[model samples]
Target: MKRRWLLSLMAGLALMAAASAQAADPVRIGFAISKTGLFAAGTGSQFDTYNFWKDQVNARGGLDVKGVKRPIEFVWYDDQSDPGKAVQIYEKLITSDKVDLLLAPWGTPAHIAVSGVVERYKFPMVGDSAASVKLRELKPGNLWFTTAVMPDRFGPVIADALKANGLKTVAVLTPQLPFALEVKSFLMPALKKNDIEVKVNEEYPPSIKDMTSLLINVKNANPDAVLVFSYPADSTLYMKQARENGIAAPFQFVMVGATESWFTKQFGAATDGIVTMGHWSPKVAAWKKAQPFFDAYEKQFHEAPDYLDSALAYMSCEILEQAVAKAGLDKDGIRKEISTETFETINGPVKFNGVENATTPASLLQIQGKSMELIWPPSIATAKFEKKPAWPAN
Candidate 1:
C-alpha cells in the first residue's frame, strides 16, 4: 500500500513537470531579410533592431505567456533581395522551421514577390522598408498587416505642401518599381487636384549606373523643383552629381532618403536642408521611450539607429505581442485578433482601414536645419516647415 502511494505521487509530479516544460518552450518567429543584394542596408538595419528587441525581451525573462515567460527564438533566412528567393526562404520557414510568426523582408520587389506566400501561411508581418500602397489591394485576411507609412498617405500631403509653397512646375524622377508606381499614382492625382504642373517626368531602370544625362536633360527642362525616388546609394549619387554638375535647383528631395541616416551623413552640408516624408523622428515627444532604445542601439552597434527600421521593428513586435497576449499563443487565435485590431505606436496612432488595405493619418516630415520636423495634418505637427528645398536654383 505504501509503495503504491509513492508510485502514484511520482507519476503525478512527472506529468506536471512535463506540462510546465511544454508551456515554456520557446516561441519561434521567422524573418526573411535581405542579407545581400540592393536593399541590404535597409534590411540589415532591420535585423539589427530585431536582435535588439530579442535581447531586451530575453533579458527581461522573455515574454509572459500565461504566467510563464518563454524566450523568443527567431529563425532568420537571407532573401538576398530576390523575390523568388524570398518565396523559397519563406517556404522553409513555414514548413521546416515552423515559425509561429512572420516578418516582411526589405525592398519593394522582394515584398511584392513574397506577399502571396505570407498570405497563404496566414501570418501577420510588418516590413521595415516595404511601404507600397499595392500591398493593400489584395483580399483582406485576418493574418495580414503592415506598419510602414504607405506612399499614398504622404503623396497628397506633399502635393499640398508644393501648392502652399507656390511651386507650380516640378520635375519628377521615379524608379521603375511598384512603390514608385503607387506613389506616382497618388501624387499625380494630388498634384492635379492642387493644380501643380509636372513639367518633366521620367522613370529609370533600377540598374542605371549613370544619371548625368538625365540631370542634364532636367537642367535644360528647368523645372521649378526636382523630386527623385531612390534608395540610399542612388540618392547619394544623384545629389553629388546634381551639385557637381550645377543642376542648381533650389529644391530636391528623395522620398525614401529619410529611411537611412547615411543620406544626411553622406550628403553632409549638401543634405543640410533636404525635405523628406518620414513616419517617425527622435525629436518628437510621442516616442519618448525611444531615446533609451536609440542610446542602447548606438552603444551596441557603434552606430546610430535607423529610425525607420528600428521603429517599424519595435512596433511590429509590439503588435505581435499584443495580439498573442489577447488571443493566446494559438496561430488562428492571433490571426483573428490582428484583423479587428487598432493600436497606437511610436509613429503616432495607427490602424488598418480594413477596406482599402492602407494606413491613415501618416505623418509627413521635413529635414529642417539638422533634425526631422513634422509638418502636416495639423493634429500631429510638432514643428512647421520653415524653408522647403527647391530645384533649378538661381
Candidate 2:
C-alpha cells in the first residue's frame, strides 16, 4: 500500500511537469526576407528590428498568448529579393513548416506578392517595408500596411513641402521600379497643382550604372530641388556622383535611403540636410516609445536603425504582438483584431483602412546633422525645412 501511494505521487508530479513544458512551447513565427540580390541592403533594418523585438519580448518573460506565455521561435527563409520566392516561402511556412504566425517581407514587390499567399491561407500578417497604390487592391482584410508612405499621399505632401519652402521648379530623376514610378505618377500632378515646374524629368532603368548624364541634365536645367526617386544602390550612386559631378540643388531629396546609417557613414556631413521619405524620428517627443526603441536598437547592433525601415518594422511587430495577446493565435480572431484595432506604434497610431494605414499622416524626414527630423505638414514638424548644403569637394 505504501509503495503504490509513492508510485501514484510520482506519476502525478510527472504529469504536471509535462503539462507545464507543453504550455511553454515556443510560438513559431515565420517570414521570408531579402537576404541577397537587389533588396539585400535594405533588409538589415527590418530583419534586425524583428529579432530585437523578439529578444525584448523574450527578456520580459515571453509573448503573452491570451493567458499563456510562449517564447518566440522564428522560422525564416531567404527570398533572394524575388517576389515569387517570397510567395513560395510563405506557402511552405504555412502548409509544411506550420508556423503559428506570419511576419512580412522587405519591400513593395514582396509584400504585394505574399498578399495572395496570406489571403489564400487565411493567415493574418502585418506588413512593413512596403508602400504603393497597388496595395489598395488587397482590400478588406488578411494583410495590413503599418506604413503611411503611400505614393498618392506622399506626392502631394512633398509638392506642398517644396512649395512651402519657396521652391518653384525641380528636376525629377525616377527609376522604373513599381514604387518609384507610382511616386512620379502622382508627384507630377501635385507639382502641377503647386505650380512647381518639372525642369528636368528623366527615367532610368533599375540597373543603370551611371547617373552622370542625368545629373548633368539636371545641372543644366538648374532647378531649385533635385529629387531622385531612387532605391538604396542608386541612392548611394547619386551621392557619390552628385559630389564628383557637383549637381548642386539647394533642396535635394532622395525619395528613399538617406536616413539609412550607411548613407551617413559613407557620406559623413554630406548626408546632412538630404531629405528622405519617412515619418518617424527619435526626436519626436509625441511618440513616447520612439527614443527608447532607438536607444535599444543602437545598443544591440552598435548602429543606428534605419529611421524609415526599422521604425516601420518594429511597429508591425507591436501591432502583431497586441493582436496575438488579445486573440490567442486563432487566425480568424487575429485577423479581426488587426482589422479593428488602432495600434500605438513608435511611428504613432496605426489604424488600417483596407490595406492602407489610415491614422498616421503622410510625412517626410530629413537627415539633419546626426539626426533625422520631421519637417513637413507643420503640425507634426519637429523642425522647419532646411536647404541641403553644397556637396563637399573631395
Candidate 3:
C-alpha cells in the first residue's frame, strides 16, 4: 500500500512538471521604425502593414504554439528616421522593456546604427533596412535578421531587364545614401560586364528639391534609357522634373520605386512608364496572401501600399508569430526559431540569406491604370511588359 501511494505521488509530480513546461507567457514583440524625418513616407506604410499582419494573426486566435495558441502584444517606438534616435529606442526595448523580440528600424543608416546593440544583447531583430552586403559582415549571432533583398543583387536584375529590352546605352542617377551608392557601385560593374554604356552618371543630394540642372545634364547625354535611384521624395521630384524638362528616353526605371502607388497617385500619367524592382506588387503570385492585406490597408488607411518596404515590415510581424510559436515565448527560443526560416510569406518563400539580406526572387513591376503589375520572371509574373504608351514610346 505504501509503494502504491509513492507511485501516485510520483505521477502527480510528473503531471505537474509537464503542465509547468507547457505554460505560456504573453509574447511581447517590439518594433523601432522610422515615423518622421526623410524615411517617414516609407516607414509609415511599413508600420501600417506591420499592424495589419499583427491584427490578422491575433484575430485568428493568435499564434499556434505546438498545440496551444497565445495572443501577441507589441511595444513600438518611433525612430523618427534618425539613426541616433533609432539606437536609443532599440536599447530601450531590449534593455529596459525587455521585449521578447526586436524589430529594427528602416533604412540602411538606421539599421547599421542599432545592429551593434542587437548583437551585444543577442536579441532577434528583423528590420526594414540593411539590404546592403555590409550588414552580413557583422559578427555572427542568431539575434539579427531582415527581409530586405540585397541592393547589390538588384543591380544585376536592372541590367538584365535593360539588356533584354535591347537597350545598350543608359544613364544612371543615384542619391547620396549608403544603400543607393551600393546599388550604383554594383550596377556599374554589371553594366560594364554586359557592355552597356553608361552615357551619364550623376549623384544628387538626398533631398534635391528641384532637379532642373540635373535633368538638363541627362538630356545632354541622350542615352536610350535612364535609371533613377533616390529616396521617395527625391525620386518623385526627379521624375516630375524629368517630364517637365522633356527629356524623353525609351526606358526609365526607378530602383527604389517599389512604392510606385504613392508616386503614381501624385504624378498620375507621369508615373505611367516607370519600371521598378518590387518585392510584392499586387501582380506577383505571392499576392494571394498580399491581396487581402492590400485591400484591408487601402480600406483602413485610404491609401495603397508601398510594396517593398511595407511587405518587409509586414513580414517582420509574421516572423515574430512563427518564432513565438516555435520557441514558446522566450527570447532564446524565439531567436533560435528566427535563425531558421521554414515557410513562405506574403512576399513568397522567405529565408534570410544572412543577417542583412533576404533571398526572395525579385518581381519586375510597372504601373497600369491605378494598379501595379508584375511583368518579369514569367513564372510569378501577373502580366507582360506593356511599354509606356506616352512620352518615351518606342
Candidate 4:
C-alpha cells in the first residue's frame, strides 16, 4: 500500500507539470471590413494585410502578450460598406464575442461610426484605412488613426507640391464624401495662399458612374494640373473617361485608386506620372523594414501591396503588436503604452499626438514608370515629380 501511494503521487505530479508547459489559448482580435459593397475595391489591401500580419506573427512563435506568447485568431465580419452596420458589428464583437482586441474598418465614415462603439466600451482600436481632420475632435484615449493623411493638411500638401514644381493653375474635381469634401475645403484656401488660379472646381457623388461632363469641363479649362478627388469606383470611371476625352493636363491627380497595385497593372504605361496619396515606399532607404515588407508581401500574395492602405494596415498592426508585448491583454495598459511610446514601423518611428500619428508628414505619391514613389515633402521623396505624358489615343 505504501509503494502504490508513492507511484500514484509521482504520476499526478508529472501530468500537472506537462499541462502547465502547454501553450496558452490564441489572442482573439476582432474587426469589421467591407467585404461587399462600394468600398470593397479599396478594402482588399487593408483586409489582406491584417491577415498577413496575423500569419507572420503566428509563424514566429506567436505574439508576445506581456512576455506570454500566444497565437492570434481573428473574428471579423463584413460590414457591407455601411457605417451603421459597422457600428452594430463592433458592438457584437465586444459585448457578445468578447474579443480581446479590435482592429479598424475601412474608410473615414466607417471609422467614425465605429469610433463611438469603441469609446463606449473603452476598447482601444488602432485605426487603418481611415483619416480626417475631424478625427482630432474625438476623444484620444480609445481611438488613434495610423495614417497622417488627415484632410485638413492634405490640400496644402498638394498645393505646396504643385507650387514647388512650378505648376501655375489647377482644376479641382471633388467627390461628395466626408474625406474628399474636407480636402476640397482646405485645398481651395491653400490654392489662394499659393496664388495658383483655379480654372475649374466641381463636385460629384461617390456613386457617380459618368465623369464625361466633368472631364469635358477639365479639358475645356486646359489647366496646368487636374485634380480629381475620387474614391476607387469613381476613380476608375474618371480614368477611362479622361483618356477618351483627351485630357491634356500635364499634371493629373486621381486621389485614391491610383495608389493600389491593380491601378497600375490595369492602366500599364498609361499610369506614369500620375499623382495620388501615399507616403511609404520600399525604395526609401531610411525605413529599414520597408523593402523587406514589400518583398515578403509580394511573395505571399503574388502581387505588390497597396502603397497607401496596406502600409497603414501593417503599420497599425506593428504598433498594436508592440503595445501588447509591453502591456499584456489589459485594455487600459495597452492604451497607455500606445499613447506614450514611439513604435518602429515600415513608415519609420511613429509617435502619437492625441488621436493622430504625429511623426510622419502628409505626403503625396506619384506613380512613375512602374512603381509608386513619394513626390511631395522633399524630405522623404523617393524621386522627382514627372509630368503626365499625353494619353495614347485608344
TM-score of each: 0.85, 0.94, 0.86, 0.94
Per-model lDDT: 0.70, 0.90, 0.72, 0.91
Give the Å shift of residue 189 in candidate 1: 2.3
lDDT for each residue of candidate 1 in 176-217, tens digit (9 for 90 to 100): 867776787788999889888888888888666889988888
Instruction: Say which candidate scores most in lDDT.
Output: 4
Q: Count residue pairs with overlapping backbones in model 3.
A: 0
Predict model 4's lDDT versus the native.
0.91
lDDT of 4 by residue, 91-207 (tens): 999999999999899989999999999999999999978888889989999899889888887889999998999998999998899899998899999999999999999998889
Badly placed stretches (over 4 Å) of model 3 are 1-26, 65-68, 143-148, 257-260, 286-288, 356-358, 391-394
